[model samples]
Target: MAKAMTIPDYHPYQQAHLNKPQLQFSDIAPLIEHYQVQPWLTVTELGRSVKQQPIYQLQLGQGDKRILAWSQMHGDESTATAALFDLLNYLQAPEQAAWREQLFAEITLYIIPMLNPDGAAKHSRVNAQGIDINRDALALQSPEGQLLMAAAKQIKPHFAFNLHDQNRFHAAGPYPNPATISLLAPAYNAEREINASRRAAMQLIAHVQPWLEQQIPQHIGRYADDWSARSFGDTFAAMGISTVLVESGAYRGDDNRQMARWLNFQLYVAWLAAIASDSYQQADVALYNAIPFNRSGGMKDVLLQGLTVSIGDTTATVDLAINLALTGDRRARIDELGDLSLFSAFHQFSVQGLAFKAGQAYPLNTALSLDTEAHLALLQQGYTHFSGDKALLQASSRLPVLLNPLRPTQGSPQLWQGATFLLVNTQGKVVQAVLNGQLISVPSGVIHNPLGT
Candidate 1:
């Protein structure tokens, strides 16, 4: 069993141990204190979260090129929150202070350190009212969204930093590849047209890309510039704010998202350099197209063979897949797999394996490598814990491929329709209850006795 973690009370060089330590809300209090003491810093309480926690804006530099950056709008995604603080600390170092001063001097900065304080406190993506603040850009119904809007209106920052995080399944370049950092210079509206907003955002991304690529080459990505009404990035760009969508995406085995925090600091530093210099504006915006879309390949935790089981009385069979333990407090649908996040007392029934039907769009060619004896031994040991009404399990050496949320949930489960299982009943016929849907595997001690008999 993984030990229950006890994060340190405080970390001097917070950025250095982001991945190692479990961060908490209390950890940020000292940072606020530090910022308060800085002569150049101007911390503002723009508004409050639904939970009534103060939302702060940290402004630095007094230049014409006003830039705005925010983090943790999705409360559970706190890597950027850590990174922003780290960036501020890095600027305090004597060696980097000169360059940092010049950058800040030329660019007035607006930073909302934690946009969704309520969500951050609870470690959830949604605000206190359970509304996804990202999708509330237009509605502005939630206090969190309203506060962000109010801040934006007040600052009128020329360039906006729309920061968030993504899942582990996202590959940097494409299938079988991992992108340590993914960036999106989001396009305005539905057309995906290259306007001033996108160009400005893309120029900044392009400037930062070279530096990031040099550090973690072939692992930086350009996000899909898709348009959505409630999307803050799209709306900000539509309002001509020149928004750059910074997605702190997946890194291997870093479930707590510390690697993301480190990369974010690097990106922020590079971003400051870009903003300060204005060097990338002349570069071709077409460079943004060269980045590959992240693919959901080689990211699953478990794969299974054919699994047939019964849901109540109806027999449902499919190739079962499971992604190992994912740690988060909120509920998010497995859009690709079409499974509801079901919770049980001992274990949660969230399927991880990519479900696909034969001759369908399921993953092909890729295989899993498992020792038969060891696998069987593990299964045998696990079997002792199987005491449910119906169970179907199969193991395979294939990566999971989830269907995108574009499909219906019913169509999603169709991929797993060939699984086999054994049924158990707590009634009189213990032995006979172990039977397949087609009356196969009849235990010898079992007798088919009618209720009347």
Candidate 2:
């Protein structure tokens, strides 16, 4: 009845070069430069970041229903920014003229693709001043946050979109699969009483869920709506603006979030089209409420089950939950252990009956370099890693090359330590190797991302 709400498939319509996780100002300058000259769009210098990088706003359309959307308030979150550029590229194409004209006749769009260039340059969540712009809504400390508030006051938009990237480890429900995309209609007050503004946001998210379900079934989630007074989404909702938060998370092999980026791009198109056609009024709020709440920490990247450990002169069976670190370039740590039956993992290796032990490090002088086959061979020999200067170790090796060799432990896996070790059979043959954070099957010798990030 709402004309199906089908958008062009993302893979073919994709035109943005957004396959990178750490996007900098330099990476996006070209896209902004290209859009500035487009006759159908209006570009304005909104403000500058703390490091003096220009932050621009892009505007289009002329009808009464005004909407404001922005991305990259946390510089490290750039999936939404890439999707914005991809959306712009598709909108500017002549083939979409008819749809664009019709949409423009009913609504106007104000978009900020990147709000924290300095933070982006450093691949950090905080701006150059080390202040989180998202949390600056009330304090108005960061200039980027100030610019956003000023723009909202000036525009008084009917709706707002707060775009972001959530942790890849967040799950849609009790399952191990990551919640690739999460939507939230942020609550305004402590009580979180639903008013017309919040209701509208909920209805819109409900309108998009069916289409999203078809794209990635059971992988969509609703963000926890605990009111955070300092966040723009919460404040905007308090101001009577319907604000929808779109969190682009990760997919299996999509370490760069390309899958999430494509979904974000297509989702935006669907949202604008639904607004233009008055289709959102038909959405059932119950569907939105039915969406699964995003579950966190209940899931991990890898899990080793029933491992035999020798600690305190006693042998005990345990389980370990491993997850890649977010701060470092690529490193994993043992997140937790014990029963862990309630938790789910992306990579689960049952080391039942296998004994866990500290892995031996190859001599730095003798093994300064190694090939994939040699790495696999060494893994079989209980050499989980190599010791050498990082610069001297080539990227060609799949095994982790530690600059400083780790001290020998008591042959017990320690919680919160780097996820690197070996699981050996009763015959003392290494059966599995957890390198960085990846589970490598010793028999198959299938190597995964060494950093496990």
Give the Cα lDDT of each candidate: 0.59, 0.83
Question: Candidate 2, residues 307-350: lDDT per residue as tens digits?
Answer: 89877789888888886775664567778878888777777778
Question: Scored by Cα lDDT, where does model 1 land?
Answer: 0.59
Which residue ranges in model 2 land beyond 4 Å of their true spot?
1-5, 326-329, 364-380, 387-398, 401-403, 406-410, 448-453
Q: Per-prediction TM-score, please?
A: 0.68, 0.92
Worst 10 residues of 2 by lDDT: 401-410
Regions more than 4 Å wrong, model 1: 1-24, 296-298, 304-320, 328-453
Evaluated with lDDT, which candidate comes out highest? 2
Q: What value does the lDDT take at residue 216 in candidate 1? A: 68
lDDT digits (tens) for residues 324-425 of candidate 1:
234541111222232222211111122222222111222223442333343333222221112212213233412121222122123224332322122233
